[model samples]
Structure formats: structure tokens, C-alpha cells
Target: MTKSDFPALRMTIDGGRLVPAGPFDAERLNSYRRGTVVYVRFTEEKDRVLVRKWFAIIDIVLKQCQTPWKNRDQAHEAIKLALGIVNLSKTVGGDYMQYPKSITALEDPELQEALEQMTELLSRMTGVDVATLKKETAHIVEYEDHGPTTGEIIEHESGAASPDADEPPSSSSAGAAESPSSAAPTNTDTTETPVADLVSVETSGDGDAPTPSPGARDPETQRLIDFAKDVLPLAANTETTGSLLSAIEKEWAPEIKKMSADGQEKAKAISRSMRAIFNRQASLNGALDFFSDALGCSVEELGG
Candidate 1:
């Protein structure tokens, strides 16, 4: 749902969540999402790494799929199709494909056409042509089939849970608890760059603020502050990225409200990534605002 559908705007948050007014339709949101709204508290430093990894994951996969139909490489093409099937699994239903081997379905003419269309749409939305992503991904070849289970991908990576799963959680339960996906997804690898380091609050003109005492310091909290300062400006300019994410957020409630249970679960995966990306930007913007004001400077000063 859009901001107007909720009682608060995207920026309006209370206790780290969107506080919708009264009598909202929780059915519109998937359950694994914890409650209704996405909870985005960066409780650990690794959470920031998870966000960057997710960003890299989406960006790298899209770039691999970008060439014209004839020029696409087989392995990269396979990876792209795998992602597409997984995407379908998220939006359409879990039953569409069971095993990760479902990537082989890309060979079917119908599936090929569908994936081509989806890849193109995602390409347009993410701008993942070679030039858009200049860096090389050396580990992609080695990182094959190393993600969560399909269910976990749907529940954890996808951001929202099923209707049944969400009912058990109180956060989406209208102020009883907090959304689970709000926390960053944990990573298997620790060396993945801590994006928080890149988003330094000190660079945001908070260099002069008094340092927290040793006893009060929480490294994760400080890292998150840095992450926000670094990401907000970039977030401002990513309209395509924003559009793609916005589409994902609205996928369940407005777009697939009439879909079947399986269909809805499948579709909610799309919302998962969308919410994850939005959380990164929203949290960063929130953090930058806090740091900027505290240091008596404009948010723009917080940069790489």
C-alpha cells in the first residue's frame, strides 16, 4: 500500500515502524513480515552488511541478465533465469517450482519469454547494464546455490511472512510487538563489506560531536548512524530503484489482493526485497537527519 493508505507517510515512524491509524486490513500484508509494516532497527553491525549484500545480490544478478536475447551468456543467463523463477516463486506461488533446480525451466519457450520480459522490466527499473555496475563480482561463480531455502527466501529474504505466520507475531498485531524483517538479514560470510563503514556520520559533518563514552558505546548503533549518512543522498537520486521497490510494496495489497493463497505467498517475495531496500534508504535517511541536526549542518554534508 502507498503512504496515503497508511496513517503515516513513508517518513512517519513511531517506535521504529509505520503506525497506521485504525482498523487496517492486515490481510493485505504477508505474515513473515512480522506484523504489517517493516521494522528496520539495525540492531547489529552485521545487519548493515546484509543490506549491502542484498543490494549487491539484486544488482549483480540484473547486470548478468542485461544483454540482448542473443548475446546473453549461458551461465549468466541461467543465473538470471534462476532469479526470475525465484521471483515468480515469490509472486506467483511456492508451488510453481519446488527445487532450486527449477532454474532449468528457463529452457521452455514460454518460460524463456516470460523471463525475458521480466529481466527487461527489472533492467529498466534497476539500470543494471554493464556501465551501471562497473565492478566485477569474482565470488558469483563460487557462490552458486548458496542462499536460503525457498521457504526462508520467501519468509526471510522476501521480507513478509504468510498471513498465518504473521498472526503469531504481535508487532504487525497493531502495536503489540515489532516486525521481524525490520532487522537486516544475516550473512553467511563475514568479510562482505560492512556498508555502515561507507556511510560514516563523521563525513556528514558530525565529526565534531562528542564521542560516546566507552560504557555507552554500541558499535552497531554507531555504524548504523554512519550508514544512514552515506545512503540518503544516493537514495534521493534513485527514482528507478524507488519505482521498482514501490511496485514491490504494492504487489500484495493492491496488485495481488485477489490472488490465491499460494499465489499470494509467491507474490509476497517480491515485496520482501522491496521492503528490504526501502528499509535501508528510510533508515539511513532517518539516521542522517538525526546526525545532521545534532551537528548543526545540512544532511548533504554526510557523504563518502
Candidate 2:
């Protein structure tokens, strides 16, 4: 089943059927009165049961690792690390690929503490923060100068040709005091000269390129880009991504409804990020604006 079917619970395939995992304590599940024992029933062959169950565990752990933290950036890093760990485990078959065990192998005490840590972190990361994370992770641009200025090269060449020049340069010494006693008068003029050369070289090589000015991108635009790069990754799987967007909608929808036209405009920008799955664009926009404005910042600020 999709994340929409069960808002609170995280679902993964277990025994060839989807089963809820994560922070839904027994009390929370019992309150819903859904059923006493939550087990997955599959029609697949008996031999495949264990394999499917193991897959389910892997999925759940992978999903959990991607869950956001109080600091969205940190959470995103955590998720990437988690994904890497899971991917590594997949390379090695058997019980080592199981859920909580696989996650625990990372030796992260924070992850082991409680499943709610993921939800709490995501909630804490503001839009601006998410935006910042996105910008940081985006491709790096390099800046370069084409070549040295004409005057600089000329001066360099002139300096380098000094020793071979026809004209002899003047000396600064005048009315110098004579030595009281000298064994012999030396006629040799000793000069140590430094020279600069106009070497034909590519100052800006193929690898060196100028970075576009930050001003080229609007703050809002950059923030949006960042949100896509950073926050989206936290929602590693389809279910997590959907749930996160849903949570944003549910929590901020009411506030969004009360926003002004200008606020609405900002909301629209945020809606674009959720366009793929968020059906209620208007509502999502409003909700995003509300959250941003409520926090005395833009959506970019929160996502950053």
C-alpha cells in the first residue's frame, strides 16, 4: 500500500506483503483498533518466504536511515550514509542484510535511540536550511582568468631582457665613504639581477572556468534548487517522499489558507517543488507559505 493509506506508519514488504514498521508503538497501533497481530500474508512459494521477509527488513532499515533529523542537512547526510550501508549489505547476502541489524552495524547510537528521531529532524529543518543544503550539494563551479594583462606581460618580458640590453642602468651610490685600509682594489662589478619572463601559457586551462555570480540566481530560485537537491534526497523512497509532502500539507494547510496575495505568490513557488505528487497545488502553496511566514522567513529559508 502507498504511504497515503497509512499516514503514521512506515510500510515495507514483509513475506511478500507490505507491513508497517518504525515508530508506531503498540499503544498507537492498538488505539486504531486495526488488528492484534500485524503480519504479512503472501501467495508466493513457501521457499521464497524467508527471502521476502529479509528483503522487507532491508527496505525498512533503508527507509529509516533516510528519515530526516532535526537538522535536515544532517539528516540528508545520514540518509545518504544509510543508503550506502544498505547498498553495501546487498552486495553481501544472508542474515547480515536484515533490517535493524543492518542499520545497527553502522554503529550510530543516535539512530539506535528511537525511530522518532527521523520525524523530529525533518520537522526541525526549515525550508531555508533545506535550500542551503541543496546549494551546497549542487555541482561546484570554478572561476578562471583568461590570461595576464598586456602591460603585465610586456613588463615581464622587458625585465627578463635586462641583462642583454644595450643601455647600462645607473647606480644609486654617490659620495660614498672610502675604506680606511683595503688589501687590493677590486675592478670587477658584480651584479645579481632578477628577471621576469613572458611565458606563453594558458592561464585558464580547460579545467578552469569561471563560476557564475551568485547574483545571477535569485535568492528564491537558489532556495528552490537547494530544496530539490537536499530535502528531496531525505525522502529516499516513494513512500517517504509522499509522506513528507503529506505531512507538510497537513500541518501547514490551515495557515496557508489565511495568506495574502503576496504570500500566495511565495506559496506557488513552493508548490512547484511538490508538483510531481502534491495534487492540491494551491493548498500546498498556501501551506508552504504559512510555514515560511510563520517562521519569519521564506520557504527557501526553511528549506535551506
Tell me the lDDT of candidate 2.
0.31
lDDT tens string, model 2, 34-126? Answer: 665645333321212222222222222222222112332333334323222223133243422212223333323534232222222222222
Q: Rate the local accuracy (lDDT) of all candidates.
A: 0.33, 0.31
Report how far off residue 271 is in candidate 1 (Å). 4.7
lDDT string for model 1 (111-193, tens) is 43443333333332233432222232212111112122221111132334344321222221132112121133544453342
lDDT of 2 at 151: 10
Error of 1 at 260 (Å): 24
Q: What is candidate 1's TM-score against the reference?
A: 0.17
What are the runs in model 1 whose C-alpha is more than 4 Å off? Answer: 1-109, 125-252, 255-304
User: Candidate 1 overall Cα lDDT vs. reference?
Assistant: 0.33
Q: Candidate 2: where is the Cα deviation over 4 Å?
A: 1-239, 277-304
Collision count of model 1: 18
